[model samples]
Target: MARRTTDINDIAFGVIRVRMRLHFMLTPKGDRQAVKYFVIGHPRNGTTTLHKLFVANGLNSFHDSRDWQTGRHDAFSDFGQLRPVAGYDRTYPNARFILNFRPLRHYLNSIATHHQKVFSVQNFINEAYRRAEYFAWALDYFKGRDDFIAVNIEAPGAVRAVADFWGFAVKEPPEGLINNVSTRPKLEQNSANIETALAALDLVEEAGRGCLVSRLNGARQTALLAARDTIRCVQ
Candidate 1:
């Protein structure tokens, strides 16, 4: 018998069409209010959890999905690895930004592990490090801006903080992390390489201070401590 085959392009096109229909259906009929929140964060950083919380509270929120046609969502989260495009703030003048922060080591580990599992190879280390730097850059670039609030999703009270920032009430935050990839067992194998690459990047020390850096090892701990001190000295 001939081997069965699947047309990947056809499947991709079908998915796109489905997404388009979904977006159209979710779009508001009348001229609704402008977007209230824009979550500018790296991938796998609890954006999904946050989006769920928002929706459960009756807010229309979407994660990692852009809707250029409708522009009717109450909140938007997860733009993947790339930093916010130029004039993002200008485009959404009234929209506030929720900047999510994650530790460099853990962030890279999760992404690398996920890539390894999905692609059957491990080559996302550089891309992960680049994303980490992008997060750091976003923090510095948006510093002191009243419209932007930086929060580490791992922290306890993060959901409440975000709600307070947005002038709303969330009776309960999500219990645990969401969209998290299983990477703990693989961290030992990947941490050293991730640490080495991150150390070389010109990351903003101040931004590093606010992250939830995991206690991976002495070297990683020392680097985080140094970065934290740099943030203090500048302040």
Candidate 2:
């Protein structure tokens, strides 16, 4: 009994030490030693869904929902502008960029819904353009990075898109997308913006040597799991 107790204590101590090490590695020492990952995408397109996922998993993930609703200038800027402020380069010394991609039409509809919810239809057209610009900037930024993983969902033949999107990335796709009722396609500009944003992430993933995880629906649980896995893997 004494020997078994000792063994159990040793195992507990080992687990605690591992957890401590993980916590320490996650926090950057200084600005120069920091690493930040930006989840850049136009309004909607599951950015919030991803944000919720990360938070749910107890990772240091930021989800500024106001960036989409209010005319808040923070989320209005291009990826380059938001990149430094978002501190993707400073938050983690070693980070992976998880880029989400969707169809153009479906993306636009999301934008419209966002606008309606916020009652900003008065200047809707201009806001849409601004959002598109941001997405373009994000794509350019993602493409420039070598450490990004681009996950494209709209692309057909991507049976595992939804699962991958949820951060599970199983070899086989789960059942659902086919039987699920499809929503209306997004607007042209919104679609374009999503395409541009995804393209940028693809470039970053290619350069970063990171793996892509895809899924059909961007759920909170998936984001949290992905975030936890990402932080663990990166750290």
TM-score of 1: 0.60
| Best-matching candidate per TM-score | 1
The reply for model 1, stretches above 4 Å from the true place, is 1-33, 65-70, 80-87, 117-129, 174-179, 183-189, 195-235
Local accuracy of candidate 2 as per-residue lDDT tens digits, 1-235: 0001123324653565455445434654344433334455443545544444444434455555322211111111112223332344344445445555454435444555444333222233333333334434444445445555444434543424433433543434233233212365435564444444444333223312222222211243354344434321221
For the record, the alpha-carbon RMSD of candidate 2 to the native fold, in angstroms, is 20.1
Q: Against the true structure, what is every candidate's RMSD?
A: 10.4, 20.1
lDDT per residue for candidate 1 within 1-235, as digits (tens), equals 1111344433664575466556555655333336557676776677887787688678887675554333556676775334233334555566677767665545666666765533211233335334445545554555456766766776777766777766676644456446566644564446556554444443324234445232322245555444433331111
The best candidate in terms of lDDT: 1
